[model samples]
Target chain A: MNKKINWQYAMMASAFLILALVPLFMSNNYYITILNQMVINMIVVFGLNFITGLAGQMNLGTAGIYALGAYTSALLSRNFGLSPWLTMVAALVVGFLIGRGLGYPSLKMKGVYLSLTTLAFSEIIRILATNLMDITGGTQGIKNIPRFRVLFWNLDTNVKYFYFVWTVAVLLCLLSMRIAHSKWGREFKAVKDNVEAIESLGLDIKKIKIRAFTLAAVYGALGGALYAHFNQFVTSLSFTTDLSISYVIMLMIGGIGNILGNIIGAIVITILPEMLRFLGDYYQITFCTMVLLCAVFLPNGLVSLPGRFRHLVKKKGKGGERFGQ
Target chain B: MEKKRYLSITLAMCLALSALAGCGGGQTPQPSQTQAAGNTKEESQQAGTAGESSNDTAEGASGETILIGVSGSITGAAPINGLRTKQGAQMAADEINEAGGVLGRQIELFVADDGGAQDTAINAANLIISQDVVAQVGPNLSGMALAVEGLLSQAKVPMLTGATSPKLVTTIDNPYLFRIRAADTVQAKLAATYATQNLGCRKLGLFTNSNDYGSGALNVIQEYLDGIGTAYVAEAHNTGDTDMTSQILKLKDAGVDGVIIWTDDAETALAARQFHDLGLDVPIIGSPSISTPQVSGLCQPQWLDNWYCVTDFTASNTSDHVTKFVKDFEAKYNETPELYAATYYGSIYILKDAIERAGTTESDALLKALNETDNLQGVVGKYKPNTMREMVHEGIICKLEDGTAVYLDSITVED
Candidate 1:
């Protein structure tokens, strides 16, 4: 078991090392932008995995929180001329407050009802963003958003933005990994598995759920702020329910409770469509078919593939035991 | 144990099959590439095959190819428009290649579908740009265009799009981006000009969808109306709203002489039907979508009588260039082309012209050539890049007569 754990750690380290050297291998601005986008998406999905995968809460309001963060940061940076870094902090606070406020009331409900409330929350945000023309720029959207700058070094180029985004993504991944192994992570799992038992064990279940939601919101807000600055534009159209669904799908495909799974899911989902672009009209169809196949075949997600393969190999080796069974 | 092995094999088979399918999809463009090569061979034969073969071999040795990227929603909510744009672009590319290509090198088009979503568009832009395209053509929707504008600008790849948002050319102000279609403000002003000056309507009414596209047009029309000191009543309806009775009734009560409807094809049709059913007989002027076949097919044929629209293209135009484009497009695509197809077709020709004039695919050179574009005739109108990089300035007003949009007058904004 110790050897296996070390091997897994080694694999993770190598994977990250390769990711860090990606820019060196592929210096094209376009690929770097895609990588940057994928990293930003991973950050948001990491936060989402905490709520949906660990706490077992069906939070579908991620896009709403993301939009809130993006708009807040964009408005601040555009109007008050705040630094992108400062705007990210402001967005996180706003997201945390909104997430806690919404989570507290909705946590009392379960399953579909909770999902519906969150969906409504997202829809409300979208509608407000569309209707509030003066504040949100209506449909024209907020443009010319300032990029992240540190005294002469502007994070304007794709390569520079890639480093900035990946650094944040790696730090957040570490934070999420810590949370997943901590006592709070266990409490989250307990709430997901058996809420009544968790409550009986003298734990504040509502508080645990709210904390999970708040953390998810903070990550989402951070991701959104990074995205707004990186893209240098924000439109309400970017924050639709379709995006929220994509995040949920990524979390599911990656394996809900696994941090590594989230990273894998983000990479595959973000890059697959791009790779399939040569398919012309059949691009979306092929992407959807592949995703469906993954869902149907890998019930526990892609993370379980190696274990399943190993189980198969072991079973094949034990011929006499198979005959006896 | 047998079950585990079986499941493992099944999963492996699925992965392998998907991998094959992905590769198959990636190779879909290879057939087109070969066709382009075959065309070049024929052209070489016409230009003295002996001498051409030597030049071709020399060129092949150098392995020079100029790639231009085309991005649009080829398979999503607005697939028809996207496909039309793609078809137009592809036709332009084929023609350019047949004419011995651009700058003594074949033009290779890298087309990608954006699926009409912001995220997908970004990916499409990234994918095309990764292939090292000299410039890009589309991502037809306004929202998708806005999303990828920054990426293209950063990469220093000039793009010409048919997306009609005024902000696409003005507010964002990406130096590398140019718009082929008239902006929404231009269309709105045209509608305003036609309704007030031609129809002689004093009190105008506005019926706008509450979404970005509709509201954006509404704001622009209001601005134009305000500049002319015209009084008007305005009401907005949300998307997925089938009922416009309340809004129509409000406009009727306001005693407006004409109603300017700003919405998509289906919604515009619905609003016009509702207005007719409500016995409001005012002259109806709408955005370009109101002139589409989809709208005409949806609304009562009689309801469309005398309805006017401000559009960038109408097949009824008698200009030799427009006639030629209509003839060629119909012969090629086996269907009458719409605004998007015409505008995108024009965009490619404009790009080809720019590339030819610049004499190189360098970004700065192409941008300069594009900025200096003057009186370049297209199916739509005379092309010229203004200070804002808006290539098309004039809009055509078309009237619906017996389910067909008839070109009535051309409206041009003074420089």
Candidate 2:
């Protein structure tokens, strides 16, 4: 078992090493931008892996959390000339506040109702962002938002921003992995498995749920803050229910409750649409079809491909050879 | 434990890396794939709106095809503008190609659908820039236009816009962004002056969109109104709002004799119809949207009574180029072209003329040629680059009579 755990850690390290190394070879600014986007997405998905993936609660208010985080950071740095580093801390605090504020009331609702409540929350945020032009800049959005500075080195170029965000993403990933593998993670899954048993065991279910939500919110906000600095602009149009749903999709497509799955899912979903652009107008439809197929055929996600392949090989070796590979 | 799981996952990463390489490998004969797909795909329901999304590289061309990029919100909020942008650009490209191509090479336009979303617009801008377009047109929504302006300027590719927001030029000072349509300031000033001077309106009521495009214009209109020492009541509404009775009632209670509205297509029509229904019995002057076919078509003749608007192009104009453009456009697309189509169509020609004059599609040369552009007659009035990069300096103010827009005056400002 100890050897197995060592292998798992080694595997994760190699996957991350590859991600960290790819940007060096990528000379294209567009690809670098896409890479930065993937990093942000992975960070968001890692947080989401806790609440929706592990705890089995639906959260469709991620857009609101992301928007709040983005606006909080963008306004502070652009308007008040605050350091982006400090603004990011503010964003994290904002996320924590939202998680507690939103989580306290809606965590009690089961399934679809929770989704609707969260959805309403996000919609209200978007509407307010759009209607409140004086502060939020309405549809025009806050532009030329300042980049992050690391001890006098500004992350102005996409490459520099790529490394900065990737660093953040990696640290967030390790923290998320630790929590996912910890005792609290087991308890969260236990809640998903049997809430009655959790209640009977004297575990405070609400507290556990809120803790998971708070972690997810913090991670999500951090990701949003990273995005604001990297893009150098923040618009209300970026925050929509479609964005929230895509985060859920990334989590589901990667494999629920898995850190590596979050990374893989974020990378694939983020890069797939760009790769499919040659398909022309059918590209959006084709991308959707591919995702739907992945969901239908590989219910456990792209992370399950190896296990499924091994099972296929074992079955074929044991006289199921008539079935084609 | 599946020990080989690590190997398979690593292989997946390899596949993804290779895919990323393929995506970034721009201008490596990939456009042909798009052309083939666009040809084979079933006809989309939104006909002609597909306008210039993809283009075929014509065989037997003299030199390499000059690629021009066009992008707009085809499938998002305000799709009409995007579709029109594409159609106008497509029509112009087709015309130039038929007229023996520009600079002895066929023009193939690459259009990206921004979906009116900020993230997608940036992606679209980067996609087209990677394809090495000499110039770009559209990205018509003002907020969207502003979002991608920095990207265009960084790439050194000049952008001729269909968006009329004055901030595109004023706020950013981006040298690459050239506003092909008359700025909203022009429209607001004209609307204000016409409502007050021609219509004998005083103590007017104002309606502005609660967006950057409308809100900024509100300040301009207010400044103008204040300069003239005119008293007015103003109200703002969101982009997708259909009912504005509450705001309209406020205007009514203010006892204003005339109304001036600065808004987009649907809202302009909605406000006009509401005014007619509520029996406001006031003369109204609106922004360019009020004159667009999309808005005017939505209204009855009765609703159009006493309504006036300032627009870049009017199908009723007797100008030979304008009429020829309208006739050719309607014949080709089977739809009437309006604000977006006219400006984007004219912008294509303007960029084409610059490309020809520069004798190379090189960014700096083409940009210089665009900057020095003056007195070039196209579909939308005359093209002349100004200090503020405002391309079309003149707007025609038209009055609606019996649901037909009658050209009343042409207001050309040198500034």
Candidate 3:
């Protein structure tokens, strides 16, 4: 068992090493830009995985959290002329508090009802951002957001941005993995699978669920803050319900309950519609069809497919004379 | 099984990447691509011994293929403007190409939809610049134009807009940015002067849309009014907002003899109808953008009585080019070309002429040609580049009589 754990650790480290090196070989500015977007999406999805995957909470208001984080960071940096790094920290803290507040309401509801409430919350936030023109620039959107350096790296180029976002994504993923495997993570699973049993054992199931959601919100908010800086702009359109749904799709497609799944899903979904651009107007329709087909056939999602396939191949090799091979 | 999974993943990735690449409106070639292609052509020209300095000749020859990029709301709320703009551009391009093309090469058009959104307009501008198009047209709305102007200025690509708002040019003008139409200030001054002089309208009330297009026109009118020491009552409404009873009530209360409206849709006609219904029998003077057939169609006969509007183009006008365009457009679309179409048509021609004059499709040369423009005849009127403060210069004021627009004298406003 210890040896098996060591192998798992080695694989995780190597996977991260590969992620860290992706920007080195990227060809053009456009590709690097897209990759940077994917990395930011990965961080957001990883946070979402905690809420939807671990705690079995269906919060469609992830985009609202993202917008809050983005607006908080941007307004702080732009209006107050504060350091953006400090603003990002502030955004995360605010996100954490808001998430806890929102999670409190969810304790009274569950399933689709909870999902609807979250969806309404996101919609409300989006509408407020749009209508409050004096402060939020209304529908014209906030522009000319100051670009900041990520850590010690100069993000003057897309290549630099690729490395910056990737580094953050990996670090967040590592943290998520550590939390996912911890005792609290097991409690989260307990709450998700059987809340009654968890409570019967005198465990604070509501506390676990709220903390998990709060943690996820923190992840989404930080990701949003990073995105606001990365793109150097934020509009109400960026944080619509469509974005939240897209994040859900990413989580589902990549394989819920796993960090690597979130990353893979983010990359797949992010790049999929972009690739469909050749189809012109028809691309969106085709993308929707593909997504529906995936949902129907691959119930466990795309992330687990490789591992499942490997398992199948090993089983087949043991059973037969390897006729196909 | 692992191999198959890998193959599927690879295929999926491949399909997605290709689709994204395909979404690009055109082959936006890099600067390196252009320079390399220029070198090969220059080498061939050098062998022919034209002696016009291959560099200069190459630049001129390259300019022959006039590239005009148009961006507008193609798939969203304002798809009509985008589609009509493209049609207008295509018509002009066809004419230029038929008449042996500009500078002996075919005119090419690259178009992208702004999605009726500001951010999309910025993206479209970047896309056009990347494609190395010499000049731009349309992006009809003021908000879209403002968002794109920054990128066009950065890329040094000349944008010949049809958007008439004066504020659209608020950013510092480089030699690269030029307008074919007169600004809203010019139109507002003309409308104000015409009202006070020709129509004997005094104590006017102004109604305009709440957006940049409407509000911008209102500002210009206010400035003109301030200049003339004329006091007027003003009210604003959204583009598609149907109710104007409150506005009409206010106008009635103000006891204004004439009401000037700045609108781009049937809402203007609706306002007129609402005005008549509310028993306010006042002469309405409207901005150029208010003269769409859709407006006339919505509020006709009684509603349109004594309605005056300033427009760059009139469907009834009998200029040779205008006549030909109307006939062709009528046959194709089964409707007369609106003023927006005419403006778009003119923009394409103006860009083509500038490209030919510059003798290079490069943005810098095209921009110079656009800036130094003077006395170029278009379907709308004569385009004097040096004097053009906006997309239009001299808007002809016309009055609606029996569902037909009767052209009055051209109103050219002083600065």
Candidate 4:
């Protein structure tokens, strides 16, 4: 999976270049905040791609996984006065536990049943977050969580935070790509495409499924930790079933199992709503309409638009039936 | 196939790149969106006053008018709260502008809708902060207020909101916020004192929806009841709980003489109906939520026979200014204005008073003027900042006669 001077690598290079140069031209921190949020979403989507995108498991408990990470990081750092970096490790461990916890249900159930199990798990977390007033501060949420600080460096400003999150996101993305392209990646896809074939070949389907779930949860928890520190606040209400579904939407609206598509999906979905803010009360409705259009037209997401056009053009040249595969 | 991959990858990122382009160009006002910005409220949507566009952070740079940003949950779970804030603030701005604008400039109210979401609320706050508003008001709920208070303090823009939770002042020690509504500590005491002194009840049963808002009030009421050496029982239910009868029945089994209910509008109405149906006939005192049109539209008239609520503003008040407000608000919005409307409406005038007194729209000067606010009359109550910068300390306790809140007594918490 080593990269040459290829177009895909070129695209990644230019995208990062554009991001690095964005704040130079734009002085406003609001846009920088949105960029930072996109980076966080990207990391979560990277995690989500493992189970829901690559492995063909529909996991909908992202908010619960995320909240656990955020709360773990926020509470540990703020309450115990631990370094944020140390608490982030704690968040990952919490994520691993949650992944293992929910991984059990994925094995016991499949499809809609598995979805419901994860949804219930997420809701249980939210309810606990809301009710455990002493711990999570109930619905009022924990605010004033301090920003990241090293020996002398403090990522306090929006621009500084964006770069830190972006660096982490890029490093995490490369790691996820490595895993997704590894031998294990093929087995995960094999488990999705034909579990019977993999099982007959003596490959442990249980390990594959659990590993996918764990990877997804781990990514989600890290995203949550980044979010908690970025906003310097954590509210239970912020993480809802809607949030879980949005990540799934990011997966579908990007090409499923496509790494590059996931980033595109997260960026488009997250910032699209903000762009539609000009519509006032109707902005959400308009955004839903746009997403529906994308879903209906590009079933494989925006990543397939070029191939779709090429396919359509070749059919026309052959005087073939329109939309003929 | 490789060429196709290259083309597709470039095309794909171009999509995201254009989105980034959209962000860079976001400050420019889109003419197509301008018409959509005007809502279908009333002829009240007249003149230059729809300056309240939630996304108009870009336009206020002209500085012709004194731009004041407002943040509210206009599109999310509790949209009514945000709408009421918008309507109330709009009316105040219109009145101020009509009476020859503040500081020789019209007060342009720019509203940023948070949709009851903390992240969106933060975005709204940042947009407001970037808009260079002299001062800001309202992201009405306590959670939204606390989330944005630090930003307001950091930006040095004073904010006034109708948040009732005492935690807004107590939890975060931010000096930028001034709570426009009576804190729950004052309101809870009023409900308890009104029950014990006015209704002449001995034992109090605490029935509450066990959410953040409900439990916060529950703790305060429990502390007050405990201080008074009153025997009490407690029962709780979820926010959207269907059958609250078990909780009510538990209170009844305790043989409590009076019940203090802390919950939101819909559930409070449900509880009141259940209390009536279950024959728990002692005085039923409720939090401020029950005094609004939300509860009135839900419960039947007779169900409120023995019901009382501690509130900051009631429509039935016969005070000269309040009636005038009630009449004007009803005429303009074609509905009874809730406490949110009243507080935000008064908030605009309060800012006007501050600007006029301070003689400058600068942040520090206006903040100083707001901090020095004395018995300044507001539609809800008098405007006077306590030590915590909470504006209103007194709350009106009202009993429902026939679906109308009949004001009984005004309880003031001594600082």
DockQ of each candidate relative to the true complex: 0.22, 0.44, 0.16, 0.45
How do the residues A1-325 of candidate 1 rate in per-residue lDDT, one tens digit apiece? 7544444444444445556677885675656766787889899999998889998889898899999999999999998998888998999999899879877865679888888888889889988888887788765578788988867898777788888888888788888888988998998899899988987889998899999999999999888888888887787878888888889988988878888788778877876766765455666778889989999999778877877898988988897687988
The residue pairs found clashing in candidate 1 are none
For candidate 4, lDDT tens digit of each residue in B1-415?
7787767667756875786787667742232232225443443343344343333343232345777777877788877777788778888877887888976777776677887888888888887787677778888877777788888898888999887777797777777889888888788888888888888888889998777888888888788878888888988887558898788888899999999998877888888889999999888898998888867668898888888999999988889999999899888778898888998999998888988899888777888999999989988889989888988978998998887778887767765
- Cα-lDDT of candidate 4: 0.82
Which segments of model 2 are wrong by more than 4 Å?
A1-15, A293-299, A308-325, B1-63, B269-273, B297-305, B401-406
Runs in model 1 deviating more than 4 A are A1-8, A149-153, A320-325, B1-65, B103-105, B227-229, B239-242, B276-279, B294-303
TM-scores of chain A across the candidates, in order, are 0.95, 0.95, 0.91, 0.94
TM-score on alpha carbons, each prediction? 0.88, 0.89, 0.74, 0.93
| Per-prediction tally of clashes | 0, 0, 15, 0
lDDT of each: 0.79, 0.80, 0.70, 0.82
Q: Is candidate 1 or candidate 4 better by lDDT?
A: 4
Q: What RMSD does model 2 have?
A: 4.4
**Who is ahead in DockQ, 1 or 2?**
2
- In terms of TM-score, which candidate is strongest? 4
**Residue lDDT tens for model 1, B386-407:** 8888888899999888876889
Better of 2 and 3 by TM-score: 2
Q: Sort the predicted structures by lDDT, highest score first.
A: 4, 2, 1, 3
